[model samples]
Target: MIEDRELQLLINDIFEYYGYDFSGYSRASFKRRVDRLYQMDGFSSFPEFLSRVRVDEAYFSRMIEEITVNVTEMFRDPAFYAVLRNEIIPVLATKPFIRIWHAGCSTGEEVYSMAILLKEANLLHKSLIYATDINTNVLDTAKSGVFPLRMMKTYSENYVAAGGREDFSNYYIANYGIAKFSSELSERMVFSQHNLVSDRSFNEFDIILCRNVLIYFDKDLQDRALHLFDDSLATLGYLALGTKETIKFSKMQEQYEQLRKEKIWKKIR
Candidate 1:
């Protein structure tokens, strides 16, 4: 609803008021999301939205949901999971215990995906998955592990392509147009709210999967996140990203070896 500079001021106000920093997000996509929020809320100007945000905490929560990207599904990018199952899990299985961080895990689909893979490999019982998201609402959703049954068909296709050996339907029970994934898959998973932009790394992980999340960030924020991952990972730990996201030009690129078409990388230095 206004020039980019004015919109940036609004973003700054949000940071000052709520401690949620969005200034490092990609400008074009951020503006588009903000514009959609403004239009949907019937705000006449950016200041109007800013005024509401400063005064209303709930409004700020809604803004965070709108501004942050959350597009995800079960076993997204099947080939990536295939590579992980074929090339990575075996190595991790040798560890006495495993710590996996699913950063930016929106609604927990892929967390469950990894859990299932670990279970099949006889590694789930000894593995701990820290699934974190910036938004608590989605973290709650992920905790519940319920999704629309209509999505099962698509997810099932992805499951097979990802080298699933059993019927995908076995993982969930269907009722009332929704499917609730088995709690067995969630037993070892911990879902929490974590801000990759500002939060410090909490644990050294054997594997970190942060797919499709950084494309929304500006270069500086992306580098900040990459550095965080670098610090959080154990030597020779794995880093998995979205297909479109890469470490090729990152300052830490040389510290990693790209594996399986760049969808996965291993920290070498």
Candidate 2:
């Protein structure tokens, strides 16, 4: 286990060595991840681990990737997507152009899922899905629109639960050990590396889904991210969070209206 003082030293060192900021993230999560890396690398001492992080750029990249490894899937919460498919899409469809940002998009499962939703709604022609993650490796995975073939069964089940009617297999071509989604869906997606902690809003969006990402941040960092989302969202746009996330007590509660059944908020003010 990484001691609190040692963790602070690492956080400071990482920020000074690399521009990435982990200071705002949850200490427990950071310590756990860093400790896992330390053990995996067979470091005998904290000094040795810190030195490896500081001196070897490649090891640092590996550390970032391991520390921020994201676990995500398509239509993660069926009811959430059901709400979007049945209610949210209609409202977004009225817009001249739909801009959706998948902030902290791990490996693009949800991004591709959104594209499928737009395609089903007959609005894919004008919808642009911008998917961003802090980790470049994951961004590259998302850019390729490929996922493990074994996971398709689970994703297909999620698709149906999310109100999808078409045979989900039609959306992708599976071969060997991977599934590659259609180019039609990928055509409208733009993938990039974006750091939610320090990066400012790039464009106004009708819908911004940062799902399952904010829970890892501390209260102040959560507020900062919510503020960024508020700035980036359009006047009547929606902000979606993970099932465990909420804005009820935060500063965003006054500006956004929460949905009755989901973790989504509409920017009314």
Candidate 3:
């Protein structure tokens, strides 16, 4: 087991060297990931592992990728997308233009999901999506908009369940074992690197979908991120979170009213 001092030094080294802040993440999760890295790399001692990472930048990048949660899929948790389509998009439709922030959007599946939803609703032409993640590797994958073709079967089911109007296959072309999404979907999106832990919110958005990303953060960091989201949303803007996440216990709960029990809230004040 890595000592607390060693863990602190390792976290500090990662931040100072890579500019990615894991210091605010949950200690238990952070420690578990670090231990997994140590075991995977065959390092018996944390100090020795740190010594190697200090000199091997490629290893450091891989460690960061391992430590960061990147699991996501198109229309994941179909019920949530159902609620968004049924309960939320109508509210957004009243607006002349809309800006959406897909915070921690790993590999852009959720970003494309939003675009498809907007397109089906005839709102895509007026919408702009800003997809951000701290991991550059995932961001590059997102920009390409290519996904394994095997996953499209599940995504097609999700699309149908989420009230898709057109054929699910209309959105992408199958090439070999990969599916490349339509360029029209990505033309309205801007992919960039943004760290939620240390970076301030860049623009006010009509809706913010930061799902499944905050469960790894401690309460203090969660509150900090919530405050940033609060500051970055327009009045009555929507805030969507992971199915397991809620703002009810946070300092800003009263400032937002629950639109659905499934983690969608609207700014009330």
Candidate 2 vs candidate 3, lDDT winner: 2
User: Mind sharing the TM-score for model 1?
Assistant: 0.97
List runs of model 1 lying over 4 Å from the truth. none
- Model 3 Cα lDDT, one tens digit per residue, 137-170: 8999999999999999999998888877688999
Global lDDT of each model?
Answer: 0.91, 0.93, 0.91
Worst 10 residues of 2 by lDDT: 252-261
At residue 49, candidate 2 shows an lDDT of: 89
Return the TM-score for each candidate structure.
0.97, 0.98, 0.96
What's the residue-level lDDT of 172 in candidate 3? 99
lDDT of 2: 0.93
Q: Each model's RMSD to truth, in Å?
A: 1.0, 0.9, 1.3
Worst 10 residues of 1 by lDDT: 254-263
Global Cα lDDT for candidate 3: 0.91
